[model samples]
Target: MSAMLRKWVLWLLGLYFVGGSGAALAALPIEHWTQPDGARVYLVRNDTLPMLDVRIEVDGGSRRDPAALAGLAAATAMMLGRGVGPHGGQPALDENALVEAWADLGAQWAATATLDRLSITLRTLTRPDLLERAVALAARQLAAPAFDAAVWARERDRLIAAWREAQTQPDTLARRRYAQAVYRGHPYGVEATPDTWSAIDPAAMRAFYRRHARACDARITLVGAIGREQAEVIATRLLAGWAAHGCEPLPAVPEVAPLERSQDVRLPFPGAAQAHILVGRPGIARRDPDYLPLLLANHIFGGGGFTSRLMREIREQRGLTYGVFSHFLAGRHAGAFTVALQTKPDQADLAVELVRESLRRFTVEGPTDEEIAAAKASLINGFALRLDSNRKVLDQVAAVAWSDLPLDELDTWTARLAAIDRETLLRAWRRVIDPERLVTVVVGGQP
Candidate 1:
């Protein structure tokens, strides 16, 4: 064989084995329903694993907190899992019981404050007995949390100390500052001020919960090791007692006038070696038409790890930062596109420049052919891993339902990715990201 022909054979074999033969992707078949109390539910039955993960999301999130009570939503969210039923044995007790009942029936709970909504999530094993107990606990948490003052004080103090500690960390400070600046007047932008947090008494939390935690404003997502029959039974039992709330309207979100702002926060850490920087602005929401396109584009831009543009330019080529990344965090109402990095205080400016320039170039020319193709391949090929576990599958299901996307959306993810070309991507890039409006915040930087 000729020398050139042998090299060609080797390359083809490598591509076939590495990129062709074993790449497989799976899509979840999503189903939807509306409960008698007006709550929406999305279910994906994947019996491959013996686990059930459920997430209950509401339309009122931190953005719903009044200016005088900024942290009210978060405080209310915490109260949901604490005390429920008589003897305060409703939620927290049943929750603990469910965990101990089934060793393999692990369960977890969490909540988040977002521009558009607040979500409470629970994961449990799908064993019939285990699932029933899990549902009962969730129902109690939803329908009858006591909001006891004693528990409230303890949790509040913990949160306050946590917030204080978070303030001391350079990265946390930078992120919070960026959110405040870019989101400005909007509920999406409000910071957890000490005043707002302190004023959040139990009465205020009770009011918030009474107003926001209702059947009319909720969504329940069920995924994994479950079918339609099982999902419906669980949904009905969990959501049945959530009385419709006649609560007050959400706090008005001020219209945030976009601006280019820059500032540096100096902490007392004299010997701290790294400066954490965050840049960007209030961006697209979940309903934006360009959401999917930009999602694909971002994976190539910076969300794709070592293969992303920011990592390639900032870390691989220049070695300015250990890791640099950018992403669009879309919520029900509003989202933010954030570019973040940490570097030696002295090299901070240089790292910021690299991020700025990369974004500038991305908006101007978009991703190259190679980058686009590779990103699509990576996203499509690796998409199945997202469903490898019931918990992960349920997470996506919750996001889809909360975002109000079509029930069959996941099935279309691959085709949608395949549909994009260079031109399509450049158009998407322009719509979602604008380098000129980027807001930069640096914390713990050099003199």
Candidate 2:
């Protein structure tokens, strides 16, 4: 790649990692209901567009992965379109036929797994003919996926090769080492290796799907030109026969454990021109009480791009690296609070020291009143961008459902931020962050 293109890509990555947005639109009216089968639904009707987006959040993330088969949940989700079993009048359709079926309808369907949720989403026009068929096809995949052994073999080999290639990267190595130190003995730290992929067969994927993909435990979010009544029918259809009626709920998964002490690990990667450094520990969950205040505080800390303190100190002032950022990976379990950067191999120590010092000072003194005001203004003003499209709105609605937040969370977002002053932010920051216990991992030229 050319130097100019490399710089542009790095800039985009920096902006994405330093994440925050503003809101300038009117309040969104979110409608909520529960189906007879115990599935909860949230709807945001936007008749301005003819497109509909349906998202289903299931508790089939890596958290539910059997220790021996770390990638089963994800593998099952990835193979949803590989095939679907015969049901009602439709014959069994293989992977290619499934793809052609969706192509015929001019709609899209996909399932993806993350740390805490396995999401299945579809996009189709609001026309009755297309929408009805789209819902039926998605239901088939949900009710009875084929989990073909031949497909799994090919996918497993491809994934193993991809993972092995990624491990050779300095950034990937740094992230792995940091996760190990921060989330030791926690499912949140679980990563699928080549051996784990080898161990996960089609049977294991089927078992994982059956155990976790139940309608009773689902949060279905719909955003489109559809009313509550139409959405209800669509949601019920998509989740039809997801699980048997009288089955008992699965056992609750354990929460992520907090780090007992700080760890400093340096991984040797000779000839690495740019060193990667990560400092992190177990942070907050989605339902954290002080989530709003902490969100603003994180923006000022490192989440806000060039205007953030980390950028000003590490890159702008001393020029240690092109970028530095702090982010909270909040989810169902406590995700890590991470501050990361890349710099020259020789300057890794200085970069690490500066990041540590920034954390210490922020935890102690907190952000100033001016900083708080700036962060709120920046975030609130740009929040509307987050919901500019149907897909983005679906994402916000799905997150609200997954986190069990109030239906009016998006409407009252700016009001909540406006109410938070310096004292509230400072108190929340101090409670959430403790620099003394942060784990530091550096992957660079020297050990």
| lDDT (10s digit) by residue, model 1, range 1-447 | 755335334432332223433432333557888877777888876565577778888766877888889988888877776656552343244434434533444666666655566677777777788777676666766677667788788877888898888866677767776777777777777777677788888889877777777777788888767788777788777766656465345555554555655444444345667888887877677778788788889999889999999999999999888898889888654577888888888887788778888889989978878888889888776766665566776777877888788876765666666777788778877876778777788777776
Off by over 4 Å in 1: 1-27, 87-115, 244-256, 260-269
lDDT of 2 by residue, 267-370 (tens): 88877889999998888999998889989999999999999999999999999898888899999878999998999998998888898899999888888888
Index of the highest-lDDT prediction: 2
TM-score of 1: 0.85
lDDT of each: 0.73, 0.85
Clashes of each: 2, 7
